[model samples]
Target chain A: MDSIEHQDHPDRELLEMLQEAEAKVEQLRVELDRRREFRRQMRADEAHEGTDEEVERLSEYLEQAQINWQAVRKFFQSAIEEYRADDAWGSGRPGA
Target chain B: MSQTIRDESTDSEHGVRQIEVDGADTAAPASPLRRLPLTGRPLRIVEWLAVVAAIYVMITAVGAIGSGFEAATGGQAEELFSFASNPFVALVIGILATALTQSSSTTTSIVVGMVAGGLPIEIAIPMLMGANVGTTMTSTLVSLGAASDREQFRRAFSAASVHDMFNLLAVAILLPIELIFGVLGTIADWFAQLTTGTDGGIVTTIFTAFGDAVSAVTSPGADLIEAAVMGILPEVIGGVLMILLGIALILLIIKFIANMLKSLLVGRAERIFHAAIGRGPISGIGSGALITVMVQSSSTTTSLTVPMAASGKFSLWQIYPFTVGANIGTTMTAMIAAFGFSGVEGTAAMTAAAVHLIYNLFSATIIFAVPFLRPLPVKGAKWLGDLGAKNKMYVLFWLGGLFIVLPAVLIGVSTWVF
Candidate 1:
């Protein structure tokens, strides 16, 4: 069956929640990529200056971004998992 | 039958797909010589032969220095090096010489030759200790490359400084013990006697014969080279010219040998680093010693760890034993140079080389055995690195004080005043 057809089943709310969680995951992925690219550029720029302070600042920024990414990723993962569980329960087929 | 958790063939999978890209012969593409049949084996043999030749050249260069020193000073080199009578001054000379040259192997080899030429064994002992301390500067210098990145610098510097701290600590503990007890020196004398044998014994005769052959072949060419250099320079500078030429030859030959050995053994080195270094300290020490002995350069071996540590693939503790092993391994050059002399000179030279080996062995046994003492170098290195990360100037100060300022000041004072 098409994913859209599955979305229209009795557990429509759970399916919609799943769709939203997926969108959030994609968004986070894009954000992570952008952050990584920005950090890469910052590193390249800091290399030319070759100062310790700029390098330290860049390191701190990357660490904070990693924490933010982990939090967002964990949130979306739980949301998607919960949607899957509810939809399965409502359909009366736990394995499916 | 067991079911797979993730199947890459499935088109609907949403998680990161397992891309099946072949590993692409990424292991440094084989050269044209390697691609050719039969020629590759011959080339490998030639490389090994070249390594042997390099060692021979190094030994001849060391012998040249000894002979040159004797020629330069007219049998009075001993009086000039009399300042080395003081252990502290001698130690400083060793450290300064090694730091300046960037190779303890070269420094110790030169020291061995000097001893054979007439530098006192007691004086050479402290210099040997200094060489150990001086060699650690190479890795510390390498760690400076990571300074631009704070975290990397922290890891790299700590990794690098553990070598420094360990050697310093070793000298701090052992040098005094040596000064008071002469324990290491006495044992070295015993060992040197056993191995070198009497003047007419087999070992001495063999060494004497070999020395004769080497001198016969190299002395003429060496005299010619000295004459050519002296022709341009004044008569006053002839001795200095020959000594400098010998040292330059030593450094160049060693660099060439180390590079050749690295290329020859890089694959084995990779396997050893990956599989053996992480197993335990014993394995790590073994691998470290093995690689250093293979390359004939502890600087090459220890400086190698800075990048690995900087990448965060390895920790300072893991690299610590390897550094210790490097300390032990670098004694091989001096040991080999010991044979270049005959009779009493050979015995004295061998004694100095033995001192180097015994000192490292004793230091490794004592420091690594005591759990409390074991972590001191690692902790001290980390602390210094942490401070360096906050302010890069701390590392600069450390490098300057330990390697440059301290050695330079000590050497100057020792030369004129001592």
Candidate 2:
């Protein structure tokens, strides 16, 4: 049944959908990285601006953002791992 | 059973879970935006408070001085003039007292009050000159703070001591001329006549009112305290307390006033001075006058330049003209004080103040305008500063000779010879 589902659909259409989804994810990841880099640059600029008070505030914001991003990244990675494990278990069922 | 449950939960059938995860990811970017703190609001409040407190403290301190004086002197304010009967003695006393106290304003105010109370202008004039000399002690003592650093101490000490040397020079040249020719007295009298006609005016009225108000508050309290202590302690203790209170009040008020003025106007004043100092003799004189008027004491105005000098921020040469300006500025106090007196005494007081002004103007013109005399104090101060740097004992000796021993010797000689 899995083979039929894989073969009945045109390979090109399936590949295109997967490629489109991956392209969107890659674009978003790049945007996120660009923004992170921009933020880092902004922090560096703020440091050179010679205002201790301003630099302190910017540093604190950067730290909180870093912590939130780490938690989100971990959440997504764990969810992906759980989905993969369930797919394997379902595929290996004795009835199949 | 657990595998089938997990598969069901992870399957595409759970569309709500995917939507929630997507929503959470989308919201992650907004958290960074929420983190900035508010700035400048608290600092603004603090600055305003400082200004208000400074003004209040200054007024209270001035009021306290007046009160202390009234309490201590009572109806015997006239007796204060007895000390100034001998001009030389008055001069020495002014110098000694100011040196000990380290404030010209205190010495000048006391002298002004005594003059208003009936001290001769001639006697008070010399005392004013002494006060000018006496005020130099503060910066000299300040220089001692830098003593551990040799070069810094030398620079600071010289910068500090130069004020003393200049005043001494002024006194040396002018005193004899005044004694013989009565030059200062004559000039002062002429100015006094020209301005107030017969002497006494608005200045006296205002000061009297202010002094009366101060005395009203402090006198009763002081009298009660003195009465309470009469049998318990020597009468001299009351007298001492009165004097101390006067000194303390004056010092505290002047400090508050200085702080207020500094906070309110120093930045602008400094800019004005910098511009003026660069503009040749006229500008230098103008800058010095403005600073003195603003600060209200030439000693305070002139001494302001000393630390800058010692720090190598500006040279002694640049500051010399400003010092001349300060000399003129200091005379304003006496001039104002003169207005508080009337008739011949007022004329005398005004004249004395005028003499101080004229003498300084004349001295600056003669000493500073001519390149030859300009370097004298600088050279003398440098020599003494070098001596001080080499042996810290010289610093002590300088203090003793200028402030204590010399004044004592002069007083002794005047007593014996006159």
Candidate 3:
């Protein structure tokens, strides 16, 4: 909703933050939905990063004592995971 | 099933360390240069056979050490081990021995054997506690492996060092109380006696039968080794030789067995962690204990958590309970090794083993149950990790200084002082 409509609301400040560049209530709604979708995509990427294949790979690295490489690669993988999430948000659709 | 676990790091792109894996290749791990024993069905069987042989060697090693000490000391065991008479010195010995071998199971097994042979119970207890502290070194180093990647190194170091903090805290809390009150030993002694029974009875008979079964398998090898050594040298020298041989066998055989078991069981461990890590602390602890038992090393258990922690998938608090479970799990080896002796010696060996188990359980229970104590390890690890990212030198000091150099210095100073 517009900042004017939420003047007496408990989350008025939050609405105003979202409405900073947008004037109409419809535009504010789209902004909130977009943010929500972005968060959902980030969570999905996190789950994918923790998949069984990755666990298997991590376990093998550790068992073989390639610990330094494991840590470094996983660091790279974390950056990649976050990057994918951000990329999806920028493209306006995941896997675009 | 031959598994391609590691492809060596090469500069595929200028800045990247492309140490990739083929998920398609499934089964076992081999080092970069060697084929290892994971090649096929027959080889897997051979690997398992080697693991079984390692257990036998481990048992006989404990026995050989016990009997070897008996021969060398000629009933002067206390005088021979007089250096460890100081509890602090004994503690340092435990730390140094375990740190050197990188396996607390080996150190504790030897300690149990020594205790059975006549090392003072009081001296052995501190050494056992020190083993717990020393065992954290390998995983802590695993965390330090990421020194070039500061953020990952910091978080990974925190995850790895949490175990170090917990064990250090446990020793700090328990050692003084243990020295003064003899709380752990009293319970252990009572339990040992109750199970073994000084007087002839059904319980004692059953215990004797079981001990005989164990001794029957181990003593022949130990006696044969002792006799061979004795034939080549004087009794005292042979005893010393046997002690060295036993220590070497325990160390080398354990590493060999650990590698094979890791190859065979890493899949199970990975599966368990995936299923259990997010479930809560108890699930984390139980899975940690289970995997350590399966793979036969707490270092393996804790080391497996490092990459996950570094990746930021699991927080340090989530990893803490698992490492705590690992401390408890490693006592299983010592308990099995205790069976190397039978009759009265067996009772003492078992008693020392019991003390190791009880101490871990008691420490874990006390730390977890007390609200104030629970967060100490996680907090301490986080602090060290934050520091480690900024100053790599401090990480070296913590790893080498606390685990090795500090213990050695204490032992040296104690020798001159007391």
Model 1, B251-302: lDDT tens per residue? Answer: 9988777766754554455445544533578887888888788778898778
Docking class of 2: incorrect
Residue A82 in model 3: lDDT: 35
Q: For model 3, how does the per-residue alpha-carbon lDDT over B1-418 read when each residue is reduced to its tens digit?
A: 1234353332322312233344443434542213442334455566678788889999999999998888888888888778778988989888878877889989999998888888878889999999988888778767756555668878888988898999989998999899889999999887777666576677877876777798899899999999899998999999889999999999888777777776666555656766774566778778888877887788877876776678776778778998999988898898888877887898899889999999998998899989999999999999998876655545656776887687878778867877
What would the TM-score be for candidate 1 when compared with the true structure? Answer: 0.69
lDDT of each: 0.71, 0.57, 0.77
- If scored against the real structure, what TM-score would every candidate get? 0.69, 0.58, 0.77
Name the lDDT value of residue B33 in candidate 2.
12
Model 2: residues >4 Å from true position, as ranges?
A: A1-96, B1-84, B199-249, B336-349
Superposition error at B259 for model 3 (Å): 0.9
Worst 10 residues of 2 chain B by lDDT: B1-10
Candidate 3 segments whose C-alpha is farther than 4 A from its true place:
A1-54, A64-96, B1-27, B31-40, B198-207, B404-418
In the range B221-296, model 2's lDDT, one tens digit per residue, is 4445445545465544554464456457556655554434433344345446535544566776778778776656
Tell the DockQ for candidate 1: 0.01
Q: After aligning candidate 1 to the native by TM-score, how far in Å is the CA of B245 from where it should be? A: 1.4
Q: In model 2, what is the error at residue B82, expressed in angstroms?
A: 5.6
The candidate that achieves the highest TM-score relative to the unseen native structure: 3
**What value does the interface RMSD of model 2 take?**
29.3
